[model samples]
Target: MKKEQKESLVFGSNLNFLRTRKKLSQTQLAVDLEIKRTSLIGYEKGVQPPFKVLLQLADYFGISIDALMRYNLSKLGEFELSRIDQGFDVDITGSKLRLLVTTTDKKGKENIELVKQKAQAGYAAGYNDPGFIESLPKFQLPFLSRNKTYRCFQIDGDSMPPVANGSWVTASFVEDWTKLKSGTPYVVVTKDDGVVFKLVYNKIEEEQSLLLVSTNRLYEPYLVSVNSIAEVWKFETFNGFEV
Candidate 1:
């Protein structure tokens, strides 16, 4: 059978199952769908429905047709699934559950995977170990593991509050630090300034410098040269501490 046909069969089976489970007769379902009873029968008999109608039916059922079809049969752990607008995308997939970032854009998928792998490695490297790097004091490095094994941190200081301090945040290492985008929060380290948490503003002209911005006005932004950065932890959404 063609791929589309197979998908349709799966969707049809799921729809039939849900309808039967709800104890809705064909006439009742057809009424709910605003379609003739014969049309509902045809759908259960593996006839393809129009795309718009299919979407409408799926929405009424509160599920993606993709979910109904059971695509991506891999049994991912709970942590690996992130629900996007239309579907649930797997961020991490392994025997042991890891971190995942859901993305539908083809180009974004590559970047998201790269970030996930780096996070996994960093997390395994003593970054999440409590007080493991405390001796380094001024140089606080974040965990790099992609696996969901570390706790989240929340920033409280006005200097980094909006994205860092007040919000729950997670840190993971990035191999390609040059891929860092300005206006995104990062865990940045500098030889002269030590460790700082703020959004990166890399537009300064003097000394190839970048500005670290805080969400709160009480804190002053500071400039750090690009060359001074030791390592950059790409910021992930803060999952801890309710706002």
Candidate 2:
């Protein structure tokens, strides 16, 4: 079979499985997505969909487009399926059961993967994909503790002063968000915002959100809903020179 056909097979299977898992019949799902029931049937029979329709289906299923097309969702057990559920799909939550995907060096030491400006968008969508993480530039920071996982992100704007544009911030992964200390700087990765370096104020308890602040007085603070946050990295240190 052609590569496109093969991929469509996976997409169709995933689409059918997800729709059935939600207990919605083809007609019901088609109506909700505003597409014809016949078209939905075609999709389930390995017919390729328009980009817009693919996006609509992915959104309706609460999954990323890459995952919907590439992953074998039907093969996953309940525990593994939960890893890609809505909460985990968008952002890593405070739950201890949640796991972070990472890379390691030849010696089995964890590599500090660098998310460059170009890869930020891809990272947001593919953070859970091991292949995507492995494709990024990876390095090791000897000074950082081996017990904690670390990732480096390249900064782009002046919203946070002192951290210059073009600089890279290496931070430790924050698994338990409740340990967040207000006023501490972090590199927060979100579904909408992509990636940003800010001083985070924990509001998870009170509002199920975080108040992200910028050092530059010109920029106003904003609250990011916990559901949208994909990952949080506590500011351990940075590698950049002042302009």
Candidate 3:
């Protein structure tokens, strides 16, 4: 058999076993991964996914691509599989964190670009684009540390009260997501949700997700998978505008 065919068989078998072990139906797993049911069915039929999707699945199952592609995970004992899950790194593609993109002044000082309410939708797609970063309005707050990278995001909605709508939240970029403090407010940039400021509860080790809690009692908390998150910024301060 061709190398590609052989590799697909291994991945499909492993994926089938993992999903069944978790007692999750295909539809449920597809929803959790934000993928189509049809595509998931194809994956279980020995069809290899694109590189990005492969990384997403690896993160979703808390396993390494190397192990998923090569090992007969179905044969491994529970203890051994648990070890494999813990051994993987907490990053997309099982690699080091990507370098953060930023804009600086002519004086070589970094500027905190503001993501206004109008620019929120595009922020997720263009965050890494230097042109996009440069186009946003820039300002500096002397009190903020020059050593760390920071960005200002304008928040909307009443989910997090006291901080009213149209409030510009300034936050510092967080590289190591695993170190996120529970109950700390953060600006989490996600693929599906755009950008949201909420109280974060780290559940990466136990469930490979983060529990986002809103301050307002009426709004219910929800879990978002690590793979869907593009960036995390710890809350530094906020500039609320009085209506």
Candidate 4:
């Protein structure tokens, strides 16, 4: 989609969801807004409404323009898990949602989820699925940061050396992709590449893609679009000992 076209896509779904919630038909809403019925329909289809008209709609709906900007229609109760704006759901933090299972320890701290080496494939396929995440084994790691969510990944190949094969990596869930530093390592979950541990660079400004580089220079870096991304975890700490 053109740069202008991308931002408008979320508008249609949000408008449709909120309108249905209020039990207002398009024609009735149009009458309320004092606009032509077709004009309202165009807005629902993601056509950019006039600036003044857009503000009027926001005021009429009791929402802010910023709220409308991030409004994903995925909150419309559970049907079947599809995708979230071609990504994952943005949760209460105004950041991407992570499937975290928690239990209080003696110190009342929550345990982090661990994805073992053998279970890597399952994590790749089921990372987005609530049921799948619920079934994974979780344990408490004392050294982790208290307020953040994290996961343990079991690596397979030598693609990322100095970190070797059959070792577990502890990565914190990254909610905001924009804050990611260049040359940082991430365990990025994607639809195309399953689960990968790669060095990532931000290229989201130039193109809607991220540059994934391998630690081992033998492997070539490639571009993966933001749409194909499901989840991104920033490397925090790792245990090189094979368990």
TM-score winner, 2 or 4? 2
Name the candidate, 1 or 3, with the larger lDDT value: 3
Best by TM-score: 3
Q: Write the per-residue lDDT of candidate 2 for residues 120-176, one digit (tens) a residue.
A: 999999988999999998888787788899999999889887988889898999887
- Candidate 4 Cα errors over 4 Å, as ranges: 1-108
lDDT of each: 0.53, 0.82, 0.82, 0.72
Error of 3 at 197 (Å): 0.5
At residue 206, give the lDDT of candidate 4. 40
In terms of TM-score, which candidate is stronger, 1 or 2? Answer: 2
Task: Rank candidates by TM-score, best first.
Answer: 3, 2, 4, 1
Per-residue lDDT of 142-199 in model 1, one digit per residue for the tens?
3444442222334444476545435555666544443557898876645555455688
**In model 4, which residue pairs have backbone atoms overlapping below 3 Å?**
none
In candidate 3, what are the lDDT values of residues 102-193, reduced to their tens digit? 98889999999999878988998888888888899898888988889999999989889888889989999998777899999999998799
* TM-score for all models, in order of appearance: 0.34, 0.61, 0.64, 0.60
When superposed on Cα atoms, how far off is each prediction in RMSD?
Answer: 18.7, 14.7, 12.9, 7.3
**Candidate 4 C-alpha error for residue 25, in Å:** 28
Predicted candidate 1, C-alpha RMSD: 18.7
lDDT of 4: 0.72
